[model samples]
Target: MKEQSRRLGEDSIGSLMARLSIPAFIGMFVMGMYNIVDTIFVSYGVGPNGVAALSIAFPVQMILMAMAAMFGIGGASIISRSLGAGEQKTANTVFHQVIWLVIFSSLLIAILTFIFIDPLITMFGAPAEIHQMTKEFLEIILLGAVFQSFGMGMNNIVRSEGNAKTAMLTMIISAVINMILNPIFIMGLDMGVRGSALATLIAQAIGAAWLLFYFLSGKSTLSLKGFGLRIDVKLGLRIIAIGFPSFIMMASGSVVTIAVNWMLQIYGGTMAIAAFGVANRIASFAIMPINGVTQGMQPIVGFNYGSKQFGRVSHSVKLGMLVATILSLIAFAVAEIFPAELARIFSSDPVLIAESEEALRIMLLAAPTIGFQIVCGGLYQALGKARISFIISLMRQIICLVPLLLILPNFFGLSGVWYAFPIADFLAFSVCVVILSTTWRKVFRETEMVR
Candidate 1:
């Protein structure tokens, strides 16, 4: 365990990043493929209505994930810094706290979802036509909420412990299981959108079991034995403080999605909503590699910062930004050149395909600058600067995108909905640059003075 922690401080930045980021990249990429493939299967089996239903139900899933991320990412930050400082007991307590947090939170969310399923879907801007389909998918997904929460939260804990390979395998196992079962459930049985939800639930359950075994079987650096179900009040609050930014980022994403759905409904109707769904899925897949890089950077930055290794922290941040920018550039080129071809992967409808193509091209115009903004946000979180991180999180979606979503559609119609994305991206990117520069200077000055 000590050796594993030591590697973050001692290893060459390039080699260490490659070791950490590749598995993370593969894991995230496969997970992204799982989403795309799920959509593809649904598009074929149930058509545009099915796609729109999934889109309406999506914000609920995001809320579930936001809760998981709050516990997972927040706990992982504390665990990484604790381990780096040679405080193994502190790390173990955090790990256990996160587990219980996920359970309680997941159950609360599930019960609330059950109570409000109808109104909730409607509130997310589900048209009357697809309301039932959206409700069916969301209810089944909520059934596995605990499992999904456990798996996602624990996966971040695993990565923080330097078990990146184990973390990678968890995602691969879940995604592969989902991909395999998607067709059998959807097509073989002709079950439609409900089947996709069921397949995802089963996969999440199995993945959570895998992570549980890793900890209980003595393979993990952090143990679950001594720490029962006892919740540490102070520590739990600390975890929430550190992780609040991630929750805001994800939860605000749900808000943005709801706003987008409402706008699409108003301006373009069901077909337009379906097209946005496809375009958004493709855009998400394109940025998965950048997300992977930031995930990889978190532990490295957290550990080094905790240990007072500012140089290593700086290097890791720079390398992460560089790699992410390169990946974003590649995604931009592909999005610009092959929007129509990419849209065709999900559906055969000519009108849907054309709408998706136009949406993709307009939405991703500022894709190249996005990687830097993402890495900058991750860097702040890794350093445990929650206030700044929270601001950065808000910059993109709430501070910039939400307003654009409101105003743009008033003038440009449905096309305005797409225009909101790139405009928000550019605005957010500018803010991140200013914040990162100022913070780095301040951080380095403090380090020099202390020395």
Candidate 2:
């Protein structure tokens, strides 16, 4: 056996979760730091123009995540299964194929975006005047697509190999660089939105390089030594199938952005859209930490499910939900009490601040409930029940959430729009509970892991 593999069943459940969750949580927060930092700067730097451009550009960025999640979630799912079964070699082979796939897919996304960037931004509702600024930011950030894909995809493998510490460090490294460069290029060098894009591109490239080094140097606990040099259709398909839920979930992010932007423009004009942007930025910032907690749970859930340690699987799922709920509630309180204060952090306009605060408070009140919906959904994913997970995410995001975001705002004006969040969460949680219960009984309860 390669030396980095975990000793056969050596750690206690508390020990293992403690070891993993700390780093995973930290990494998730760090992972989002630069994005949030630049977002704050852009919102204030060029006033509403920069923030709106960023809002328009944000969906494109999300698509990149969807692509990464496609392979990352897929590859990591299989890798965790392999590890639980004590098959490092199989895990290695899968990792190799996934890396090469990342490179190819990322390059393809970049080229397509470059060719179609303008029309896409316009399609998202960018006005004729802000078109040039939006295009510039998109062009610059799009250059980093390959690196973002590589780094994001590989980070999942790093964690799956039980090197959650290393994965966390990798994100911290990239985030620090992004933070340092963002101010220098944007303010010191006066690059504006272009600067933000350049800084991000360079930082992601460094992260991708770090991931490459970890595997090639024979230091990764799980190595892709002799596998995935070339793509295998069968292997790739399995990865995608498991990952498809994440893709749909993330793709739904785009859908929400479109609907919200179009509604905000009609009901409240640019101020409303900008206010929506503020709420999203703060919400995403808070959710980043919640996502970390869920990520920590994924492998634990996966390993236990694969080992048929049903009780451990159940415990971890519950723990994840508890943590997510608690954190989200705290965030909701902060946003609700000081919505204007939160908005002031991004911009100084009183009108924007007031509108944003109401939107932020309304958006966040139901956010704590998101913890249950996500972790419950993730429990299904960790068990490789992608279809169930996908349905919950689809209905939550598309079926219930989108409709609320559109219809609610019309009746209550801006406040109605903001209140759409918790309403959707309330509905989605019930749906998620049904899926969780069914999958738990049908899959985990009835099946036994094959030795």
Candidate 3:
């Protein structure tokens, strides 16, 4: 374990990326597949309204994930850097604190979600027609929210300790279990949308259990011992500060989804919302591999940066960005070529098929540029530049996308809604290039002077 973990600071960039990224990609692919599977089973079993209900429930779920990211991504950065600096005790402390934080924060979120279940769903743009179904789905989902949050948070820590395959297994096992159970619960048992939520809960619980066991068994570099549940105020604050950008990045997704849902409700009604849901799922699937690439790069970048190996850090980021861009281009091709066919897989409804086809194409038009934007944000996060990372993340979703969503729709209606994504993608892409180039140049100069 010590040797494997040490290689994060020693391995060649290409070799480390290959070793780390492939598993992360598979794990992320499975993560993305969960939604695709749910949409397929739920649409066939419970119909289009069921699809809309899941759509309305998505933003709330994103918020839950945001909470996880805040702890997981935040703490992992600390853990990786600590390991790089040869401070195993500090890394252990961060791990234990992360677990405690995830547990507490998730429980709090679950309670609040349950308390405002009705209002929250309504606020998420659940149309009157599908409001009841949306509530039912969200209710069951919230019950298992803690498991989802904890499992996701722990997975990042596992990877940071240089156990990428283990982290990948956590997601794979959960997704496979969810896929198998979803059909049985939703169709055979006649549980409908609630069944889908239940399946997710059970799967997440299993994944969480596996992670907790791994850390507790003395198998990890950072174990679940030597630190009490009570968090150190100073350390806890640092974790939150570093992770806050991830929280906002994910929360911004929730905000964007809600805004889009409301506009769809106003302009195109429930069917439009359903179509957007299909597009969203496909888009998420496309992005997940790119996300996995950045994730693979995170430990590498954080460790190298901490060890002050600026050259290695630079190499890793550029390679990751190139791989991510290639993946995004492939996704773009799939979106453009098979838009209608992909939509039809989710629903047999003709109108939804047509609507989703168009939306999918427009939304992914600038996907070729999206990889650079995301990679840059991930690089910032790895370098512990949370404020810059937060800005880049916010710009893509809130700063650029939201205002354009509002104005463009006023002029072009539904078409304008479709156009907003590519416009934001281009704008965010430009910003990322400027920021990355300027920062990297400074780092290179500093390293030269030090030499």
Candidate 4:
């Protein structure tokens, strides 16, 4: 673990990125497949209604992920920097507190979700026809909130300690398990939507167990010792403060999804809603590499910044941005050129494929520019500049996307919903450039002063 941590500071930027990101990319890429797998299986087994139910359920899942990211990303940032600064004790404490926090948050979310399942599904625009299925699916999934939150949140912590492979393995293990189980439960057992949810729940449990064993085995730089389930007010606040940006990013995504679903339901009905679901999943798959790259860059930037290696930090961000932009461009090309083909991967219904293809093209029109914005926001988060990160995150999802979703659909009708995506992407990308430029100067200037 010590050697792994040291490599983050000493390795060549390019090699380190490759070493870290390939595994991270594979992990995230597979993790993204988890959703795609479910979509495909459910769509085939239970039809478009199953897809719609999952779509409605997406926002709630996003909220769960947002909470996990708060502790995971937040705790990882502190731990990586603490390790860089040689504050082993601080890193350990944050790691331990993160575990307890995840448990508490997950339990709370499960209870709330159970209590409010009806309203939640209704708010997500689930038609009366699919409400029962959506509710059943979410109820089963929410029951495993502890596993989901702990597994995901701790994966980042594992990477922070320089165990990127282990972190990658955690996601891969869950995804693979879910992949194998989804068909059996959904098709073989004829369990339908509920089966898909069960597969995911079981997979998360195994992943969470995997993480627990690692930490307990004492192979990690940080362990669950001396600070078991004990929360220091100051440390807890710092963790939340640092992770707030990540939370906002994901939570805002949930909100935007709900708004989108409502708009689609109002204008287009079930077909529209299901079409948007297909497009959204494809978009998510396209963005996974960006997520992986950003995840890889996070520990590198946080560690080097803590150690005051401003040059390496700058180099890492630049490389990350370049790689991300290229990946986004590739995604844009694929979406533009083969939208229908891609949509067919999820469903065979002519209406579904045609509508999804159109939505995919229109929504992703400005996707080529998204790489810069995503990388820029992640840079701020890695440097512990949560305010800037939060703002950047907010701009793309809530501030820009939601309003566009509201106003554009009013004018263009269902097509306007598609327009909202690119319009928001373009506007948010411009704002990101401005903020990132200003932040870049301030960050480097502070480094010079310290030097």
- TM for every model, in the order presented, reads 0.98, 0.95, 0.98, 0.98
Residue 153 of model 4 has an lDDT of: 95
Which residue pairs clash in candidate 2?
Answer: 97-228
TM-score between candidate 2 and the true structure: 0.95
In model 1, pairs of residues that clash are: none
- Candidate 4 segments whose C-alpha is farther than 4 A from its true place: 449-451
Estimate, for each residue in 1-451, the C-alpha lDDT of model 1 and write its tens digit: 6566678778888887887899999999999999999999999999999999999999989988999999999999999988888889989989999999999999999999999889888899999999999988998999999999999999989888777888999999999999999999999999899999999999999999999988889878899878787989999998998889889988998999999999999999999999999999999999889988998899999888778888888889889999999999999999999999999999999999999999999999999999998898888888888898999999999999999999999999999999999999999999999998777787667667221
Residue 426 in candidate 1, Cα distance off native in Å: 0.3
Q: Give the clash count for each candidate.
A: 0, 1, 0, 0
Best by lDDT: 1
Put down candidate 4 lDDT per residue, 358-383, tens digits, no spaces. 99999999999988988888888889
Runs in model 3 lying further than 4 Å from the true structure = 444-451
lDDT of 3 by residue, 244-342 (tens): 889998999999999899888888889889899899999999999999999999999999887888878888988999999999999999999999999
Instruction: At residue 130, give the lDDT of candidate 4.
Output: 95
Give the C-alpha lDDT of model 4. 0.91
Q: Which wins on lDDT, candidate 2 or candidate 4?
A: 4
Q: Taking the tens digit of each residue's C-alpha lDDT, what string does model 2 give over 219-302?
A: 876755556357789999888888888888888998888777777766877777777888788888788878777777787777
